[model samples]
Target: MTIDIRPDDLTSPEMAELIAVHAQTMLASSPPESCHFLPIDGLRQPSVSVWSMWEDGALIGCGALKELGNGGGEIKSMHTRAHLRGRGLGRLMLDHILSVAKARGYTDLWLETGSMDAFIPARRLYESYGFSYSGPFGEYAEDPNSVFMHLHF
Candidate 1:
C-alpha cells in the first residue's frame, strides 16, 4: 500500500478526530490516573507540528513534533491505527518523524513512553532507532509507568 504522510493542520476536522482517537487509545491502555494523554488543544500549540499518515485514502496513523528549544524536540502522540499494526507502519512513521526533526535542524530528539507492557513495542522501536534509556525529561519523574529516552541527531 502506498502510505502518504504529510504535515497536517492540527485544527482540521479529520486531524482532530484522529487526535481524539489516539488520546482515547492511550487512556484505554493506561489507567485514568496515570494517563498523560495530551488534549487536542494542547497538541495544537504553535510549537508543535502534527502530521497525518494515510494509506489508500484512510487515516492510518499520526504523530507530532514539539520544538523543545535550543535545537531539541520531543516526539508526541505517535499512534498507528488498530488495524494497521505489525505491517512495518510504525517503523515508517518513526523514520519519517526523525527525518523531519533532522531536516528542521533539531540536534536532540527525546521522547517519553510508558514502561508498561503496552509500551514494549514503542521502547523497542525507539531503541532500534538509537534512542537510549535516560533519566526522565520534561514533566516526568522516574515513575514505574514512564520510560525516558533520548537520541542525539
Candidate 2:
C-alpha cells in the first residue's frame, strides 16, 4: 500500500468532505471551546501549508503546518480517514511535517490536542515523536480540555 503525501490547495471535493468529517469528529469528542482544528478558510491562510495523503487515487488523510514566525511552527488539522486508522498514515504525515519544519529552519514545533480519553492515541503519537507536555503557546490559554505539547529541534 503506497501512500502519497503532497501539497494540497484545499479545493478538491474529497478534501472538503474529509475536513468536514474531521471537524465533526473533533467537535463531537471535545467541547467547542477546546477544539482548535482550522476551518477551510483558516487553513488557506498564507502562513499555513496543507498536505493530503492519498492511496490509489483516494484521499486517506490530511495535515498542515503553520508557521508562527520567530523560528516557531504549529501542527494543525491532522486527520486520517476513520476507516484507515492503524495503518501508520498519521506517522508518515507527521514525519513529512517534521521534515518540512526542519527544511524551513524552524527551531520549535508546538501542537494542541485534546486531553480527552478519545485523544489518547493522538497524544501517544506526538509523544512518540518527542513532543513533551508544554504550556500553551501562541494564542492558546491553559485549559483542562487541551493538552499542549512542544518539540524542539
Candidate 3:
C-alpha cells in the first residue's frame, strides 16, 4: 500500500472532522482533566508542526511535533482512524515524527498519554520505539491518569 505523510495546515473539512473525532474519542476514554489532546487552535501554534497521513488519498492518521525549546520536542495529537488502527498507520506517523525530530536536531522527545487500560496499546507502541517511562516534563505535572515517556536521540 502507498502511504503519504506531509505537513498539514489543518484547514480542510476532513482534517476538522478527524480532529473533532480525535478530541471526542480522547474525552470519552479519559477524564477531561486527564485528557491532554490539544484543540485545533492549540495545534496551530508557531512552534507546532502537524502532519497528515494518507493512504491512496484517504486520510488515515495524523500527528504533530511541537518544539519545546532547548533541542527538545513533544509529540502531540497522534491519532489514527478508529477502524484503521492495526494497519501500521500509527507506526508510520510515529516514525515520521521521530525522523523529523532527529533531523531538526532535537536531543529529546516526550509525550503524555492516558494511563488507563484503554491506552495500553499506545503505551506499548511508544515503548517499542525506545521511549522509556519518565516523570512529567515541561509544563506537565504528575498525574495518576497520565503516563509520560521520553526518548533521547
Candidate 4:
C-alpha cells in the first residue's frame, strides 16, 4: 500500500471518523478513568500537531504530537484503523511523528499507554523504537493501569 502521511486538520470529516473510532477502541480496552485519549478538540490545540495517513484516498491511520515545551514532546491520539491493524500502519505513523518531533527540535518524546493485554503491541512498538519505561511525565500522576515511556535524543 502506498501510505501518505501528512499534517491534517482535526475538524475534517475523515479525521472526525478516525478520532472517534480511536476513542471508542481505547475506551473499550481500558476503563474510562484510565484512558488518556485526547478528543478531537484537544488535538486541535495550538501545541498539538496531528497527522493522518491515507492510501488510495482511504484514511488508514492517524497520530499526533503535542509540544510540551522545554524541548519535550508527547505522542497522542495514535491509532490505526481496525481493518488495517498488524499491517505496520501504526509503526509508519509512529515513525512519522518521531521524525516530525525531531525536526521541530524536540530533545525528548514521551507517551502514555495502557498496561492491559490490549496495549502490549503498542508498548512493544514503542520499545522497538528505543523508548524505555519512564515515570509519569508532564501533568500525569502515577496510575496502576498506565505505562509511561520516553525516548531522549
- TM-scores for all predictions: 0.93, 0.99, 0.98, 0.97
Query: Order the candidates by lDDT, highest first — what do you get?
Result: 2, 3, 4, 1
For model 1, residues 1-153, the per-residue Cα lDDT tens digits are 799989887767778888889888878777666676668888879998888899888888888888999999998988998877888888888899899999999999999888789889889999999999999877776777677899997
Relative to the true structure, how large is the alpha-carbon lDDT of every model?
0.86, 0.96, 0.94, 0.93
Highest TM-score against the true fold, candidate: 2
Error of 1 at 20 (Å): 1.5
Judging by lDDT against the true structure, name the best candidate: 2
Q: Candidate 2, residues 57-110: lDDT per residue as tens digits?
A: 999999999999999999999999999999899999999999999999999999
**lDDT of candidate 3 over 52-114, digit per residue (tens):** 999888988899999999999999999999999998889999999999998999999999999
TM-score rank order: 2, 3, 4, 1
Instruction: Point out where model 4 deviates above 4 Å.
Output: none
Where does the lowest 10-residue lDDT sum fall in candidate 3? 53-62
Pairs that collide in candidate 1 are none
Off by over 4 Å in 1: none
Off by over 4 Å in 3: none
In Å, residue 151's CA in model 3 sits off its true spot by: 0.4
Model 2 lDDT at residue 152: 96
Q: After superposition, how far is residue 33 of candidate 2 from its true place, in Å?
A: 1.3
